[model samples]
Target chain A: MKLLYFAWVRERVGHPEEEATPPAGVETVADLVDWLRARGPEYAYAFAPGAAIRAAVDKRHAKPEASIAGAREVAFFPPMTGG
Target chain B: MAVRLQREPFDAGAEAARLTQGREEVGAVVTFTGLCRRGADSGAPLTALTLECYPEMAEQELARIEAEARARWPLADALVIHRHGRIRPGEPIVFVATLSAHRAAAFEAAQFLMDYLKTSAPFWKQEETEEGTSWVAAKAVDDDAARRWDEG
Candidate 1:
């Protein structure tokens, strides 16, 4: 799977995108976030609990419970501020 | 309908004109432009605003918003253009134009598109000041504004 970060999430994670493979039990966006958080302090900071992070699965807005099964891309970012 | 995500600036007048040109059937046209401002929350002078977007996802999300407006309103046409990259204060950042046969539909649809865009679009803004740069936090007011459309 390809993971993307944006805004401050990207800054904290130190990169915009990356490729990673989650274990079989990582089935939802929340689980993936938890998996990434364990990778390093940076990921932990970016996906810290209570952070206002939003996620997308394959470019569509996704809830935390949204399944990531067979997904190719997932993006995480702060809430959008566009107008 | 048109959704353009560009790095270059856009002219609101030209965009509005393009939507209404030669269309006598269009009785109402509403155009809105959002601009970068010189003030920051900390009372620091803002130098510029950097807008970042997920290239492919931004386009798809914008098209989805435009399509929703079209489905909900009796719109003749709608155009949305949002700019990404560093924008100086006083520069236009986004433009939305909607056309319809009646004033109510045109006005409401344009507002609907903007409200949704503010909260749902895949774009983030960072403000630069002498102190430093920081991401603009999403406001609860914006979420409330978007949520209003869901109620009667």
Candidate 2:
């Protein structure tokens, strides 16, 4: 799956997008975030539990409990402030 | 229904004219244009605001919201145009217009579009200030504004 980051999350993660294959047990967005957090310092910082993160699965806004089974794209960012 | 996401600046007058042109049945046209401001809340000099979005998702979300506006109201047509990339202070950020047979519908639909777009759209904004650049946090007030429509 392709993971995209935006705004400060992108700055912290150090990349706009990347392809990653999470371990088989990771079936939901929250689990994926936990896995990503363990990968590196930047990922840890960006996906920290306390961080005000919002996500989209395949371009649609998603909650942490949302499944990622058939998703090809997952994006993470801060809450939108656009008008 | 028209939803356009582009990097080029648009003329609000021209866009509204295009949407309302040749529509004799339309009695009211309500238009709202959002502009980038020079300062955020810090009172520091501002230079620009960088807008980022999930390309395809942004258009889809805007269209979905516009469709909802059309469904809830008796609108002749609805239009949404949003600009991405770096925008300077005073540059137009977005434009929304609704055409309807009554002023109430036009006004309500336009406000509805703005309120929903402010919260649900997949776009992020970062303000560039003299002190330094910072991402503008989403306001709870915007979510509350959108929630009002849900109550009905």
Model number with the top TM-score? 1
Q: Report the number of clashing residue pairs per model.
A: 0, 0
- Write down the worst ten-residue block by lDDT for model 2 chain B: B37-46
Error of 1 at A30 (Å): 0.7
Quote the positional error of residue A41 for candidate 1 in Å: 0.8
So what's the TM-score on candidate 2?
Answer: 0.98
Two-chain DockQ for each candidate model = 0.92, 0.86
**Candidate whose lDDT is highest:** 1
For candidate 2, write residues B1-152 as lDDT tens digits. Answer: 89999999999999888888899999999999999988775778788989998889899899999999999999999999999999999999999999999999999999999999999898899888878888888989999999999999
User: Model 1: residues >4 Å from true position, as ranges?
Assistant: none
Docking class of 2: high
What is the lDDT of every predicted structure here?
0.94, 0.93
Q: Scored by Cα lDDT, where does model 2 land?
A: 0.93
